[model samples]
Target: MQFDEVVYRIRIAAGGGLLKKKTKSEERVILKGISGMVLPGEMLAMLGPSGSGKTTLLTALGGRLGGHLAGSITYNGKPFSNAMKRNTGFVTQDDVLYPHLTVTETLVYTALLRLPRTLSKGEKAEHAEAVIAQLGLSRCRNSIIGGPFLRGVSGGERKRVSIGQEMLINPSLLFLDEPTSGLDSTTAQKIVSTLWELANGGRTVVMTIHQPSSRLFYMFHKVLLLSEGNPLYFGKGAAVLDYFSSVGFAPSVAMNPADFLLDLANGVATAESNEDQAAIKQSLVNAYKTQLSAAVKSELDVDSSLHTPTNDRKLKRWSNTWLDQFSVLFRRGIKERKHESFSTIKIVQVLVVAILTGLLWWQSPVDHLQDQVGLFFFYSGFWGFYPLFQAIFTFPQERMMLSKERASGMYRLSSYFMALTLGDLPMELVLPTVFYAITYWMAGLKHTAGAFFSGLFVLLYSVLCSQGLGLAIGAAVMDQKSATTLGSVIMLTFLLASGYYVQHVPAFIAWIKYISISQYTFKLLLSSQYESDQIYRCGTNQTCFVRDFPSIKTVGIGGRGSIVAVLAMAVMLVLYRLIAYVALMRVGVTRN
Candidate 1:
């Protein structure tokens, strides 16, 4: 891989969205005409201080960057393109695995989604096992890759799993971002050494490192050192110390060369004034321009037409078919969510809430129109809010994982989105049933089979709609706390406009009732239960109970309303999921 005259300009917003309308914008150059090359068998390490643009440069090289960037990058002397992107692998700084999946299961699922379509199930399984063994994770192959609430693999093992994900593709070029940031010194060295070995096997590797020990620094064949977005040195790793010595910044006895170089780049090498540090930085820049740039360019300069095509046929858009991707994601999703979906604590919480609600509205009288309306709306508010609050965490928690996998072209985002909807449907469908079974009879709701089962269907479908909305919120925000807050606000808006709390909203916002799932659910349940003619006295004030709610017809709670309510839920499901898919596609390899 080779890049020349690479430049990137980032527009910095003055003060986020809260800024005044007429605020002037500013532009900061993150990368400034950076140029370099990596041969087939070379390990290049990018070292620089924070904000020095190491990660930015890595993203450009991987062909995954967004926004304004200008550069000419070539692979095997041909200009880089999507085909080259497919032929490369990038492991992000953070490990993005499903915490609920075991090490082996994680790899197997990724392999199924990413491996060539020609590979059979057995072949994919074999490939996953090989990666497990190669990463030295055989002992913990079946252990979970846990999160904050779970305990499973060690940090080093998790890092290996992250690397193994990219290794599964056997790409010609690999890029990693801070692969050793949180690892122990020994583990850090092992990772770099493994990259060196991969380079020896004729696959080019590029990575950014924060601080490396002397031993680890030597593993890289070439080192690119940047200072304030400019290359201070871009040449052989071993010759870095020699170059610094020639520039009169030699390291003291027993001092690590990497540390010395960092001090020089950070403008703290000498104990003199700030003016002296500026002078030193300028001198280093001039030295590279005068002595090294020409040599580096000569080594990488190649004729554009000298390369031959590697493949003669067209490449498949995806390794797995859409259905295959869906089925795999479907099964993997179930496995990842089984514990949380069916856990004893979650079930207990549902039961407890159901029992409490049943007691609150227990033995509701059929003659009291107000109680019936209250009961229906209570069910609506409870089911709608509960499922939405829980589902809000779904996409936000997995946003990073999805972003990384999708960026790698593992599977179509549409397939994953559809699978996600299907996978949660079963669990989502079951949980509402459990709640209804516990609360419906206990609350003395309409006991007839048609009334009971129809209400149950409406309840389940309404909950599904709420879950879809939650997913959209999570995807749109891509942050758990923010999604939670937004979901609460949305559910509250739906609740207030549900036509049960206020009975009549003001003319200005009455239109919100049409969009609230709770309103439809409440109307559907009311129509299902009250279509019967049986009636009793209402507090000795009347013999019939129809006078209490005169707005039923006006609110559209009739036979047609029942059907429209169900259809509305279905429409919301599709609409919210479509919104989620688009939001997910726009999300990148990392949260903003």
Candidate 2:
């Protein structure tokens, strides 16, 4: 892999007012003319103090950085291509693993989705086991990869698991960002040793290191030292001391060469005066540039457009077919999310809400038409809010995992999404059906089996629609707190426009009732419970026609047939999910 004159910059809004239509923007340079190369069977480590552009250059070399970038980057004397993307593996700074899954389970799913289709189930399992043992994760294979609140694997163990995920595919080029960020010295040395072993296997390994012990530093075959985006040194790790010593910046006392290099590199980055920082950084950059022999400079320069037709022919889309992808993703989604969907707390919450609702409208009289109508609307409101909040959290929580797996070309977004919405159906529908079984009868809405089943269908349909809307919001926003806030505003608007709170909404704003899932749901539930021919008692013991009731006349504007209500809700259900799919497509994968 090689990168020449790689430069990257990002534009950000400098300042803005609450009502202003525009804001001042400025560009910040991240990487400036960074160039380097790593060959197969070599281990290269990027070393620098914080804010030294180490991570930025690492990302740029891996073909993952996205910004205003210039110059060229090539792998194996060829421009970056789809085939190289599939053959590469990238581990992010943070280990984004499912906390609920055990180490074994995590690797197993990755193998199943990513390994070649020619591999059978047993072969995939064997591959997963191999990665576990290679990474020394056998002892914790069955332990959960826990998170902030959950206790599971240790820090070193978790980092190994993250590396194991990339290793499972047997990638020819592997890139890791600070794999030992929080590990102890012993653990950090072990992680570096593992990378050394991988490099010796003929795979090109490159990584960014925050700081490393001397032992860990010696494990690298080559090192790239940077300070404020300026290269300070680029050569063998063993030779770094001599290079810096010859430049008159060697450590005064005997100390670790890695520490001495950081002290020298960080001097410019943390200098008090801006002029001094720039002067020192520029001199070091020029010194490093001048140090390169003319012969080596000529050898390093190459055409960025060089084509490797031999590797280009190996560009394959995915490892498995659509059906296989769906099955694997479906099972994985279910296994990972079942705890959140059907935990004891969630079940108890649903049961408690159902019981309270049943008590609120217990055995309402049939002639009490106003009370029965209130019950139907309340039921509609409950299902709408409950399912919306539940499904709204799906995509936000999985954004990191999705980005990671998709970048690796493990599975198509469509397969993963189809499996996601479909797999959760059975689990999502169960609690709502239970809520209705109790609340429907206790509220005295209807007596016949046909009435009960038809009402159940409408309830489930409303749930699906609300859930899809939630998914759309989550996917588009990609932030939990923001999505929840937006969802509340939208759900409240739908509830208020359901034709229950105000029988006659203003004509201009009343159009909301058409798109509101709650509106049609309330109307459908009203029809399910009562008929037009029914009669209710009036003030003086005289009877009034149910057709003349206020809610009936106002909410029944779309005609009395359940077909229109059902069909409208169905259209909304499909439309909302289509919106979600498009939003997800925009989030796709990161590439060159």
Candidate 3:
């Protein structure tokens, strides 16, 4: 693999976040004229501090970086093509695994999604088992990859699990971003040893490492040291000390070579002030460009004998068909979400709310028309906010994992989306059904089977709309706190316009009632229970007009005149999801 003349930059706003003026974005250079190569069966380690361009260079080599990047990267004699993509794997610094899934389960699902279609499901499972043994992870195969709140695998084991995921496809070329970060020295050594072994197996491996120990540092066949986006040294790991020694910057005392090199890259021990430090840095950079540039440049220079790079390599087909993708994703979604959606705290919250509402409105007579309308309106408001808040975090929580998988071409975005919207039917409906069962009979609004089922259907329909709206908002914002605040505002507006709060309103805002879902649901629930000509006894007289009721008039319901309301909500049900799909296209499931 080789990358030549790699350059990258970005444009950032000069003004503050809250500034109102249209400030011009300032251009900032990130990686500056980076160029290097690693042959097959060689393990290359990139050494740098926090702000250096190690990751940017790695991403560019992987064909995953975008944003004013100018470079030519090729594997063998071929350019970055579909065939190269299929044969390459990238492991990010953060572990994006589901905390609830066991290590065995994690790899098996990955294999099922990524392995060639020629393999059967049983074959995929066997492949996962082989990877477990190969990575020395068999002892912890059944352990859950835990998170901040859950404990299952150790830090080193978690990192291995991430590597195993990429290994499941047997990729020939691999790029890893700081895989040994945050691990103890012992664990870090073991992790690097694993990479060394993999490279020795006739595969090319490139990784960015931070602060490796002496033992870990020697495991790399080659090393590239970077500082402030500039290359300082690129050569054999064993010869770096000698090269710096010849240039009058070698370590003054015995020290880990990695530590000594880092000190040199940062202009350490050679400066007395910040200006001196900058002068020292400039001297080393000048030395490398003059002494080392020719050799590396010739290695990367064009050769007419090499095959011309092209993207014409036929891409491999996905492992599963579209239908099969949906089936597998749907099952996996259920397993991953069951514990979160059906936690004891959430179950108790719904049950307690239902019991309280039911007991408050227990067995009222038919003459109590106003109280009955209030009860239905309460139901509308509760379900509107309940389902909306529950769904507002689904996409945001999975944003990282979704991006990683999509970039890897694991599954079709449409298939994963269908699994998301359809697979939640059973889980999302469980508590609502329970809430209805507990509250419907306890409150004496309707007793007949026809009235009962119709009201249930309307509530479920409303729930779907509310949940779709949540999904749209979540995808659009992609921030938990911001989405939550927006959800609260939207649900509040719908509640205020539900017709039970105010009968008469100004002409301009009166149109809010037409768009409010709560108004329609409240009106439908009223029409299902009471007829237009129904009479009641009020104020010592046995004659009261139901049509003249203020709440009923605002919702505009009279004698089955709510067909438009039902249709509007149906449109909203599909419309919100379409909006969500478009927003997610912009946010969640993107590939570059």
Candidate 4:
């Protein structure tokens, strides 16, 4: 309910890269024993200029700072636990929302995963609606969150929604980073006022503000003035002017408190005596330290007697509920997937490619033998690319949403990994089916119902394999641009390595062919075509024509190997999914 004592001390300095080559001359101490406290129903504003360790202090308070520090933070009368970390909510600078989802859908999905399972669907929806109303987002609740290509919610409403999501967990403490960085003065004041109301409702709110307007500045119950990570003041906002006046400067009524504090910390106008400034700084530091130490010690003593045992029992109980955890995660994943475009462009693309292939290899009375080889190569080669492309584009988009949800503890990594794999099936089936139906008949392959179904199955399987590859790559590299580039390179390498065009590359490169999803898919398609051609000949001309196509003979490894290849590709997909999940989990855990 309250942060009894929060101490954030940071040691930052330039260090060497791998091999210990010196990168900079000396180390710098950014924050030096900065400490503050927030009681229940209190709003604290971290006010400082740029690069003053405002955000860094918040990170340290939240146990997100991956830095060396010498301080302790206590929630109430005990050291903060991992449960506190899980319960605490952090609203980041960017409002990371899925552009396709409406505000209501977004909140509903978050509630389903984060709200206790004891709540019914109607209860969850009711809770979500209440939060939306509280955040002043009801007007835009049903509107879509937009991206560069689409029009949706406005920036201010989006920001509120971001905060609303954090509030959904009903956390006792909330940390926000620059909540009004780019907003207009009026909008910024509104946001700050909303935060004030939240704090008044008993949620301890702490946030960093760079240069808030006068109205916005006056809203804070307490202000933490920091300069290069050193605390100047950490008390009542009204006391700031009096403190500055004591140091020999009278602040004008119109002068912003934020500016007045920055000037004092950075030493503006006439520079004060070094000894005097140092003494003033030391006095404030000691005051905070004493207060924090007492609070922390008191909290620790109480926690030792009252909460530690129960905390362990709670953790043990939660650990046993894996099924419950997975169900919540699966539901969230389904919601996220439903919002994606699934690329209508891709569907159209598959149809176009199918029609082109059909036209290029249209059936004829006098079949040129070389045409069979070419058709076999084309079908195998292009179909192999399907899975690769699908994975590359789709997975990157999903990864962004996944990262946000994963951080919020929507579900476990494995649940999302499975749900995404299954969720993609419907879209995956649609495009590949369209491609196969058009290309199969157009290429003039023997069209017995058996052949048609067999080719469709092979194509669909290949596409899934490629989707797996893309998802793996996307998960491994969190950045969309980097993932796309890496995926493209890998797909290209696989395409060339598969024995489609360069049939007899060296034995050393032969290993690539075995692992390549395209290799098996191409081979299977060729075998299917050969088998279908032979069947059609038996039915139409009453003669076996399998020996007529030389390419079929060269595809000599037989259908058994091709089946094994498909299975192997599927296995590789599973492995990639596992690897992706592991990588993503590590990322989520480490991210601040």
Candidate 5:
């Protein structure tokens, strides 16, 4: 609730070259004994020139310092705790959003995760709509939050949506870093004005702004001007002029206050006298000390020692545990099925591949069991790489949105993990069904009812295993380029380890087969199709066909390799989900 005498100190190694070792020293103090408060119904603006540590100070106050914090930060006279940090909402400079999701869907999805579970879906939707209207985003509520590839909301609107997302949780304190950094002048002013209005409505708003326009400067009730990590001014907006005047240097009437302060801070202008300079500096120091002390007192009065009333009385009735959270996420996944891109290119790819496979092994009778086994392996391996490649290209966009929502405490990492697992089902089912139908029939594999079901089961298993592997790889690498490179490498490795070219793998590399989803899927499919006693007779000499197929039969549970395939897929799903969870937690939802 308040920060008293907060200081953020940093030390770095000095310059070093190949011939000399680096020297360690306290190179600089990024935030030198800085102090500020964000009381209810107040808006505090942190202004400073570049490299003045404005963002660093804001992060210190917001409890997002990670390993960079120094000194004490107290809330209501008690040291800041994790619970206190959770009560605040922070919006970073980047507009992290899902390009495919419309503004309304984005907000509603966030609400489902962050809002108390007791609220009905109708209540949640109503709450989200109200926030949308409040932020003046109603005109584009249904529009997509676009990137270079997709088109929808403008930069200003997207910034407002990010703010709306934070408000959905009704946080008592809101922190924003350069909220309008990249927007045009008109849009920037409008955004700051909206923030001013929100502060007036009983929310504590603290934001770090760089080079705000003249009009925007007047919206701040209080300002913290920093220079080289030291506080130069911290007090009322109008008082800044008087403080400057007291030092015998008057600012031009037309000069912007922020620009004037920054010029003085950078030592570009000289004070009339040495005493004038000292007097002005002393005045700022005293003002900061007094204001910081006052903030501490205020925070002490409403300390957590005294029982505070609950703000969300309505939230008491909604009680969704982890299971309910999973279910809600699962439903959202189903709804997102339409977002899957099944373009003409994808359909054409399937058709082209089908024709090629069919023509290569044209109407091969069941007697050619070796050929059938080869066809099964080829189809399974090809389908295996499909999901992996698709995920590498598409998952990054979803992850961008996921990170934003996760930062706002919309849902637990596990809930999102479950949703993604469930959401991919429809596409997985459709692609494999199409690929297998065309390939299996075209290759002229035995089409007995049992054989048809076995082929379909194998295809589904390949799809699931591929998706799981893709999800794992996506989670592990956050960047698109890195993920794509890693995905290609893993797919290639799997292809090699799947026994396509090398029938006998080295002893040390033998374990790779267990780890490779393609290996299991192809192996099971090959065994099921090539078994000597199966209805689909390969050659008149069944012995030769059976001997040619790998001896690693699907021996686990029942004679059905399909069952083993299912078991392997189940294991892959859990492994991938676990990898996703750990990666999400370590890297977090924030892109930077």
Candidate 6:
């Protein structure tokens, strides 16, 4: 694999928070005309200080860069294509595996979603088992891959699982970002050794590593040292020390060569002032150009004629059919969400809120019109806020996972999205049902079964609509905190215009009442409760309930409006999901 003159830049957001403007965005260069190459049967380790363009270059080469990039990347002397991308795998620094899945299950799902359609279920299982053995994860194959709250796999084991996930596709070229960043020295060396073994099997592996142990450093076939987006050194790892020593920047003692290289790249011992550091860095660059460029060029200039085609077939960009993608994703989604959605704590929280609400408005009747209206308002508000906050976390929590899978060309955005939305529907419906069931009879709003079920249907629809709105917010913002803040603002605005709080909205903004889901819900509840036109003794004389409250009629309150509310919510649900799909496609891949 080879990349030449790669350039990447991003426009940073101008101001802080959600209220900021984008008018004054600034451009920050990530990669500046960087170029490099790696051959089969070799492992290249890229070394750089923080923000030295190492990961940026890796992202560009892996076709995952989410900024303005200009470069020519080629594999097998041809321009990089979708087929090449499918043949490449990239492992991010953070392992984004599902906590609920066991080691074997995770790899199995990855194989199902990524392996070719020609392979049968048995074939996929066989492949997954093979990978588990190859990665030395057979010992933990049945152990659950855990997160901060769930303890299961060790960190080194988890990292290996992440690599194994990519290996299931049998990729020819692999890229990793700081695979050993937080591991112990022994574990880090072991990981590199494993990578070295993989590379020895004729797979090209390129990775960005920080301050590696000397033993780990020698395992790499090539070393590309970068500083401030410039190549300070690029040559054989074993010869790096000799090359640097020849340039009069030799280590003072028998220290780890990786540490010495980092000191020079980070300017730790190179100079006492900024200008002096710049001079030292420049001198190193000049030395590399004069002394080492030829040897590097000769090594990288692999003869195209020498390359031989093997029996291994190239893989397609996506392995699963569209329907198959959705099915696999839906199954995975259901498995991952069952615990969160049906957790004892969440169920208990919903029940407590429902029972407390029911007790507050127990046995309410028509004469107590104020309390009935308040109850309806409370019901609408709770469902609105509950589903919105719950769905707000859906995208942010999965951002890294989605990014990794999407970059790997695993599945379509629409397929993953439809599966997620469909997978959550059962829970979304069931939770609201529990809330409605506990409160419906105790509150005594209506006795007729038709009205009760209709109200429940409308309530469920409203909650889903709210969930859709939350999903759109989460996907568009890409930050949980910002999504939450924005969702709160939106929920509050809807409540204020709900016709319960502001009974008489200003004429200039009267349109808000028409759009506020809460208003529609309140109208539907009122219509259901007063469908019989029952008489109430509010002032010692009988008076019709609808007559006392004429605003319900003007606001289009009835069974017809209830039907309209459900339909409106359905449309909003689809609309919001469509927006979310578009947002997901751009979340980590779009330039700001």
Candidate 5, which segments miss by more than 4 Å at Cα? 9-29, 76-87, 248-253, 270-320, 334-337, 341-347, 366-371, 392-400, 533-543, 549-570, 588-592
Off by over 4 Å in 2: 19-23, 268-277, 293-296, 299-309, 557-561, 588-592
Model 2, 1-592: lDDT tens digits are: 8777778898987685788667679888878777777777899999888998988887777776777989878786777667787678899999999988999999999999988899998999999999999999999999999998889899999999999999998988999999889889999989889999999999999999977888888889988888888777777899888877676566666776778778777663322335475566666777788885342356467555433444566656778899999999999899888988999999999999899999989998877788888878888998999999998999988988888888777888889999999999999999999999999888877789988997898899999999999999999888899999999999999999988889879999999988999999998887776677777886677898777889887777335456788899889899999999889887654222
Worst 10 residues of 6 by lDDT: 308-317
* Positional deviation of residue 170's Cα in model 2 after best superposition, in angstroms: 1.1
* Per-residue alpha-carbon lDDT of candidate 3 for residues 1-592, written as tens digits (9 for 90 to 100): 8877788998896674654766787998888777788877899999988888999889888888877998777887677766777788899999889999999999999998888788999999999999999999999999999899988899999999999999998988989999999999999988889999999998889999989999988888999988898888888899999988887786767889999888877878433334476777788788889987777888776564643344543455465788878888898899889989999999999999999999998987777878888888888999999999989998999889989988888888888888999998889988888898788889876678988888888888889889999999998999999999999998888889787887777788988877788888888877777778876766675677776677776775644457987898999989988988889898636773
- TM-score of candidate 6 against the unseen true structure: 0.92
TM-score of each: 0.94, 0.94, 0.96, 0.84, 0.82, 0.92
lDDT string, candidate 6, 371-453, tens digits = 87788778889999999999999999988888778777788887888899999999888988989988989998778898788
Q: lDDT scores for all predictions?
A: 0.83, 0.85, 0.85, 0.69, 0.71, 0.83
> Which pairs of residues collide in candidate 1?
none
- lDDT, candidate 1, equals 0.83
Return the clash pairs for model 6, or none. none
Look at candidate 3 and tell me the lDDT of residue 550.
78
Tens digits of per-residue lDDT, candidate 1, 268-314, equal 65444355777778888888888888887786777656454655247
Which run of 10 residues does model 3 get worst, by summed lDDT? 306-315
lDDT of 3 at 57: 89
Query: Best TM-score goes to which candidate?
Result: 3
Worst 10 residues of 5 by lDDT: 549-558
Candidates 2 and 5 compared by TM-score, better number: 2
Give the clashing residue pairs of candidate 4, or none.
77-299, 77-300, 78-299, 358-442, 387-466
**Model 2: lDDT to the true structure:** 0.85
Q: Is candidate 4 or candidate 5 better by lDDT?
A: 5
What TM-score, to 2 decimals, does candidate 3 have? 0.96
